[model samples]
Target: MLPKLGTNETMPLQMTVGLTYDLKDDYKDAGLDPETIAELDSPATIDGLEAALRQMGFTVVRIGHIKNLTKRLSNGERWDLVFNICEGLHGVAREAQVPALLEAYQIPCTFSDAAGMALMLDKGLTKLVLQNHDISTAPFAVVRAQADIDGVSLPFPLFAKPLAEGTGKGISPLSRIETHQQLREVCTTLLQKFAQPVLVETYLAGREFTVGLLGTGDRTRVIGIMEIAITDTDGLYGYNNKTDWFDHIQYKLLTLETEPALFKSLCTLSVQAWQALNCRDGGRLDIRCDETGQPCLMEINPLAGLCPGFSDLVVLAEMAGMSYQALIENIVNETLHRYNLPQPRQRHEAA
Candidate 1:
């Protein structure tokens, strides 16, 4: 087991980290919808991550996506660890592609493993796991077709989205339905457009928040809780709001002084969900309150966006007075400690 680093302690090691990512620009001309590539990283994101890694004294290698990674691996290329942020473009197991490949080669990688990635990608499956563990989540059902919509016993005013999508790919003003007719219409459109099952859940009408976390298993800790206040006419943080967050959203960092009980509840629930899902390294968990003011787990983002100052996680870190470099260092430190690898020596005094 690796020893935890104290404030003045450090592990001296020189390592080469292979970075795996799917660039949004690479697929802009692939005849795909804009939402399809929204979760993919930008060139700026990759550049920022690479710079952070190099600053901490690690050799950084740009290994593109799974195709590029497969080619390199087949040719016997390897690294001390793979910093994977690949949101693949295929099926339910898309996000698992890179981690699964690395696992097969007995290589260590950052973030969750293949099983966790596959399970978390499917929103319906993730809710099942959460329910089984007695975790608080909204009542939901998966609709695979138009016929399945009739079988949904959930009450009206339901929120529906693609069963296995991220970055609010299938969410819109139409997602929040108040009638059976609207539900049917939205579900039909989503099923046909996304080619995936629709997850219709009892709509949580209260405040929305996302909790940032670091570490894994028993070592996992909550970094901060951020309340996502939607300022638009329609109160849904869909793709458009997320893409143009500057104008449509306000992110407030919660604290014990302002929201004592709610803040604790959100942190406790987020950590429980993260541990139950066996997520590694770091990520974020989205939570929303119901009509009765009870918080419910919305989803788990095990591989969250890392676009420096733009991503939610980065924003949360910044709000908490944690620098971007420190956020990256914390993630790297947690991974190294989990894997019993030599950790990086502290380079900067700021956090």
Candidate 2:
């Protein structure tokens, strides 16, 4: 039962949610094959969220790609909450821009606000913050230029990826380097190829896991832990492997294969990492077990993927015995609960 606030007072109503999604403005510059871009861009996934919100009795508003969101929000139309899915344009600041826009309007939105998104997007900054909190993350350094790799003390088999990138953009099989020469070559390649700062980290070889968290502060709950079982491939979960490198052996789901008790430990650590970062609403923590089986934090995804079947959170939730419907409903209810909104009256209660 929900705590009673005031019986006579009507619960605040939510209406007309605004959506923001990445439109991929850099199709030509990113060298994204035109066909791939077309496939990626057109499939607007607002339907599931829309149905959920509507079922909760809210009107859904399609705010298609508010480019200058600050100026637009300042125009004075009020919304109860901005259902922020704005992953932003295909740039480094894609995730950061949405909540910044909402903050201007003082409108509460779903997921982590802009500041958290900004902090987590930069891999270097996220690791530093984790280290300060006494979190066990792999040793890492940032290479802004190829020249910056010279002073790195973290030993190889190091993993290198974009410092500010998400969605596994520049990660490839060759990202793991075993020597100084390979590091230089990979760093140079990233500088020339991706045109972004490269994050080099001492790679920890062990089982990989992901944690899904919901709510903030004490209200947070660990939904489940999922392990990334390399059932078929010999390589890491890099771009090529994730995109198309799957073989028959690598096709197994890790959660299904991992011991139930061990996975629970992973779930515990993932939530710990979320708390360490002060993440709000819901998000995901990526973790890996070192050779000794101790969990090492990788990074947090405040805007954890929500693409129904394809998302990591969905997989984690399924493993934990919750259906997709139940997970989405929980997320919506939690967001509403954050503002102290009243829950919908059940038929029995209404009667």
Model 1 CA deviation exceeding 4 Å by range: 1-13, 348-351
Worst 10-residue lDDT window, candidate 2: 342-351
Tens digit of lDDT per residue, candidate 2, span 1-351? 123468677755545556555454534577766333431323335666666667767777656565645545667666666777666655666677778877776676788768888889888898998888878888888999867888888866898887876556777667878999889988988888767789899887898777777877778888776667765444466544444433411322345256766766666666666877778877788787766877888788888766665567776776677666666667656666776756553321110
Q: Which structure among the candidates has the greatest TM-score?
A: 1
How well does candidate 1 match the true structure in TM-score terms?
Answer: 0.95
Quick one: how many clashes does candidate 2 have?
Answer: 5
lDDT of each: 0.90, 0.69
List RMSD in Å for every model shown: 3.0, 4.6
What is the Cα-based lDDT of residue 224 in candidate 1? 87
- Reference-based lDDT, residue 31, model 1: 89
